[model samples]
Target chain A: MRKVSSASKNADRVFRVATGVAASSPVVFLVVIALIVLVQAIPSMKFNGWHFIYGIQWNMGNLYGALEHKNGVTAAAGASYAALPFIVGTLASSIIAILIAIPISMFTALILAYRVRGVLQWILSILVELLAGIPSVVIGLWGIITLAPWVRDNLAVWLSHLGPVVPYLRGPVGTGLGLLSSGLVLAIMIVPIITATTRDLLMQVPILYREGGIGLGMTTWEVVRYICMPFIRDGFVGALALGWGRAMGETMAVLMVSGSAMNLLPHNLYSPISTMAAVIADQLDSALTDASQMAVHALAELALILMVLTLLTNFLARWLVTRTGRRRSTKAGVAA
Target chain B: MGKSISVTDLKAWYGDSLTLKGITMELDANRATAIIGPSGCGKSTFIRCLNRLHETSPGAKMEGSIRLEDEDLYTMDPVDVRRVVGMVFQKANPFPTMSIYDNIAIGLRLGGIRNRTELTDRVEKSLKMAALWDEVADRIHTPATALSGGQQQRLCIARALAVEPEVLLMDEPASALDPVSTLRVEELVEQLKESYTIVIVTHNMQQAARVADKTAFFLNGELIEFGETTGIFTNPVDKRTEDYITGRFG
Candidate 1:
């Protein structure tokens, strides 16, 4: 072997360090954000204890009152913060979004991946991705002006007929600016995301496998159902988890449509609600006004919870992708 | 029962570039017929048209009249034609997510065989016919992809056999295997020919001579010569066939 040039060795070392830093940057940012949120949340954690998650009431209480000390933390007299309603709102709305998004995205992805070709495929794929590029604030404005009214006059009334089958469908559909609207907006936001990911995955299935199904007398749909669909199952699931994380963390659109209800639980599907992400944005003004600063700390605690939730889902998505990817690689040969 | 195939003036094209140009042939019942040719010589396209697998490709078109035991294969539903004439590809392609049992059982289950005992029996029978049951019987429930290359190819044969087709089309089925595995597949083919009309497209002349009772030579998208395997190798009919066999030119 020829001796390595000193300049080439120096360049290689620099390249390795640069790539290493690039790869680790996301982890560094995540840890830093998590640490800052935890430090800010300590005061609220000490004062609120377990009630922060289970209790529905969220009163900043007498911002002008004398300070009270408890659990080594100081706050306004009579101040108490609990996040049950926000937590429930976050989970319920995101779950609804995922349920609504799955079928629509899956069928769209299938069509995009297999049914269309050439210019048509290009146009449809671009249109789906364009949906994702729309600003969330613009979608929120549309939700308030167009979607909210339609839900109140049309959808909520029509669905209330199912009250006999599902008790949650019972009437008393208020102004549509609430949980259903928030969920719908979030669904619209995440559908493009999941659909794009799924379409890419479907396209990646080798033609050899599909040919095997076709040669076996399987119909076109049968080939897709039994072979193509199963081949991409794990990746599809990972996309769903990633979509769930996005829906949970979304703020601008959900905040505008969620009706910003506080200190109360929704009794029906149409009831107004507030997610943690939306609440953090909605209450920042009022929270900043508290002389004791407890309200700000409580908001930070909410941020911490939201971060953890999204982080867990992202990790789950990566784990699922890698696990299934390893299994697929094995099929290539013994060397894999 | 095995079925004979008569193809007349079968011409196939992918987007105006003709791949199989007006080839007519007769494949006997319960006998292995090998189509031997260089790459791009339309031998693969000819067999794909037998099972209607050729037209599945984009821009693929074929003008042909193929009769399987007096039933016009072209007019029949493509799916039905495929059900009667099963195909094994050049490379092994087992369903990655399915177990060996599920891989074999999928066709039976989809064809509406719901009885558990019958499914198990058919799976076992198909695997045994492919000469793979003895090696994989204990791990039949494991993922089909976990098997070796040659074993996966055999598993694919078992999958096709479970459908119980009247004709079997193999396109260079052992080209990707090791020498030992290739020999095993050749032996399996000799056995399968006893029950089904088999048409194989092969690049290896020796493989064709070993496994095929009759051999057909293709060159430049047309059939140059076809005859008994022994005669085609030992005696020369067409100048092109002689050249290809004598290693003068493909």
Candidate 2:
């Protein structure tokens, strides 16, 4: 605890300053990029007013119809921004991804952490660790090349085999690059991330709780169900949200598989889709008309909405973690 | 009523490394038996084996025969043994997720008790048995985790008693507690002996003399000596027991 000499103190200050800047550089860069994106997105949106967020119809030729756009609500700007499709795509894909990924990841995590404990566990864990290293383009390319065609042929074959029992299986016939295919690719991509995170959380469960439950005559599975699962529920939720956020905003893989078709009320699994990021990527370049520009700008707004939702999920998980923090110090607040 | 427990040729192995070497002792009905030994000498392991709790450790193994009134404990079934014999840990381990009332009711529900009135009566009775009813009666709905260290320990005792087990195994139940709570637990152990056969493992030798009717001394996983509390503490036949008791060696 004693103070160092002035020379040592100066060296320490220099070292601290260097380390602080190095550590914060990545965060600073990310913030700057986000700010830039926000700045670019705002001006065009402000010009469109409330109609920018609404109005389903979109066309380029109706830009300056003077009678129609008396207050500058021109038909050329004819219902430029309808965020409904992108919003639906983002939410549907995210929900589908979460529903498919969470259970698979949780079970994978549990198996890795508890059932398998030696070099096998380590190898599998390393494989999951390696998943994060796979660039998004590789996954997008793989989905485009391998998954799409397989889905089409397999679903047709599967639907034919179960013709009477299931009809929807037949309906999503040859259009492999669609909502369902995109969801499948997203699920596969998200699982490794969720698994790795949930495995870490599962590992965080104290040995004492597992011992306590088993000592009470609970079976191994029962111990996991009642004690281990409940103890780390918040953390598992955090992991799911992490995966969900990543999947929801994923641009390249979704674009490769989503078939790039935008329409209303996407009920069909075989139906082509376009997520917010994909629309921004695909349409932003060809935004020659004012309406097309506004439409692309609206996709950026959707990105902001997805960010807020992800942030909200993360905050709630963190809150639950704080609320359920079990410890010795917590006891002093009450007598019994 | 509490039942007599007979342990014969009890040996525990932690993955081929012998821990408890040939421990044979008879615990009398409605009496407390304190097992004393140095840390890692298998006193705790031996106690946990009575309720099949030793299997909690990943590599722990057992080769022994323990019986509660002719019913073989080691072979009967872990669930049945757990039902018949309950254990309290060295550190208090009240389920943090449960309320005080629910903590007591855990055993009752585990045993398949469904009636609300029966659950209430059993919870009340168990809490009273552990001397925790008066302190926790009103806030029984409060999280059991909200209690003090001593209260959590007592709640665990109450939890064990809730199922009306014939024998109780306590593995240094007061080690993590304050002196006042230690005294309370000791007093509760004495009171509990009226209807429950008790086996306690304690690091404190004076505690053995105070509450234990019979005392067993273990060393390096071997049963060194066991007899009346007075004889084991004052007139031990084995030099090892004498050394352990008189602070000659751990």
Candidate 3:
């Protein structure tokens, strides 16, 4: 055994402390932001009580007058601070985005990882990267101009022929600025992220598994389906979670296409809706300029809720990844 | 039924680089043939060519003829050729997501056998044949990865056996195992030779001596000599074979 050098030991300690600080910095920032939102949200929380969360109506006509007669006006009557509409919009659009994105992303990933080769593979990979790098505002503008009109003239009309039997689809489609358009925009935006992550994960699967499948006379598709896909199932879930978080927080794109209406519940996929992020972005300037402190506090409360939702989503995703990762390690341990 | 294999002037390439160059040999039916060579000698590539797995690599190409009995392996569907010729790799590779039972039954299911009873019967029979039935019977429903390394290797053997192929190719199947597990695999191979034509590539000369009926020595992508196992070891035809056998050089 050799004696350790003091200089080297000091360097090692420096490296450890540097990395530890870097790792904990994100947690520190998250806590600070959360505390700020919580403090700002307290006024609205006191004024609106539970109705801010549970009530569906969002009328703000009497909010200015009610500010003067603060003691007499009920929370629901004064500010109409209920957030169910935005919550519904956020959940529906994000969920719909995931549902639309997953199949396309997985198939694209499979083709890129297994079926394609050489120059074509490189071309496709670069294309996906380019898609991810495109600015969200640009995508939102494209959605508003192109995708919304196409959907309104084509898909929405086709659905409307289902008639009164499908009451949700019976509503007049409004130039396609609605839940479906917003979800579609989100789906397109997240496709590259999900596909890239899934492709990388699929490629990471050990060659032994592929050979095992091939040796059994399985086709390339079978090898991917029976072996590679299951091996990276946890990674696929993580990719979906990554896309989910992105969709939930996407302000510019959703705000552009979602119509920003205060519809408590969407009538159908085509119905105009507003998400929490879209609402905050749309109203923040007006809320600041106006004398209504209630509106400002209410937006802060929504921001707090969005922050909590994001944190919960990330935590759940981390938990799920670890659970699957732990199971795999235990399996490897048992084999060892 | 076991099938004999004949290779004539076989050459294999990975991209532009030739790995197995013009190798010729005849493998007897229901017998174990051991291919012994040093690293980078293409012994593994030769056996992989028999099952058409070598060609699965990107830009991999092959030349000359490989015949299973009288049928041209090149003319047959590569997938069908693989089904007729099962392979066990140097590493144990049971599908990690599968249960012990499912791992064995995967080949059967891929072969379009859907009956539950038949799958179970074949799974059990394959496990028993691989000498793994007793050890894994109680945990057949558990993930295959829950077993020890040796058990997992046997599980892979069972998986290959369930498909009931005419020929089996093993590429240093026991090289990764401990001495005891190596001995168990060698014994299993000896038993397996009664039912299938087996070609094994090994780095271990003693393993070749223990399990093989005939031995083929490969060096620099060429066959140095091949004959009955005892004769090849005792009475070498080439100086290189003599040197390799005498442990002078690989």
Name the candidate that leads on lDDT: 1
Writing each residue's lDDT as its tens digit, candidate 3 over B1-250 gives: 6899999999999999999889999999999999998898999999989999998888889998999999999999999999999999888999988889989888999899999999999999999999999998888988888788888888889899889999999999998888888888999999999999999999999999999999999998999899999999889889999898788986
Candidate 2 docking category? Answer: acceptable
- Fnat per model, in the order shown: 0.46, 0.22, 0.61
Chain A TM-scores in order: 0.90, 0.78, 0.85
DockQ of 1: 0.49
Q: How close to the true structure is residue B71 of candidate 1, measured as C-alpha lDDT?
A: 100
Specify the highest-TM-score model's number: 1
Which lDDT tens digits does candidate 1 get at residues A205-277?
A: 8888898898999998899899988889888888998889989999999999999999989888898999999
CAPRI tier for the interface of model 3: medium
For candidate 3, what is the TM-score? 0.91
Per lDDT, what order, best first? 1, 3, 2
lDDT of 3 at B169: 96
For candidate 2, what is the interface RMSD?
Answer: 4.3
Tell me the interface RMSD of every candidate, in Å.
2.7, 4.3, 2.5
Off by over 4 Å in 2: A1-31, A46-79, A153-174, A288-296, A312-336
Which is superior by TM-score, 1 or 2? 1
Candidate 3 chain B weakest lDDT stretch, 10 residues:
B141-150
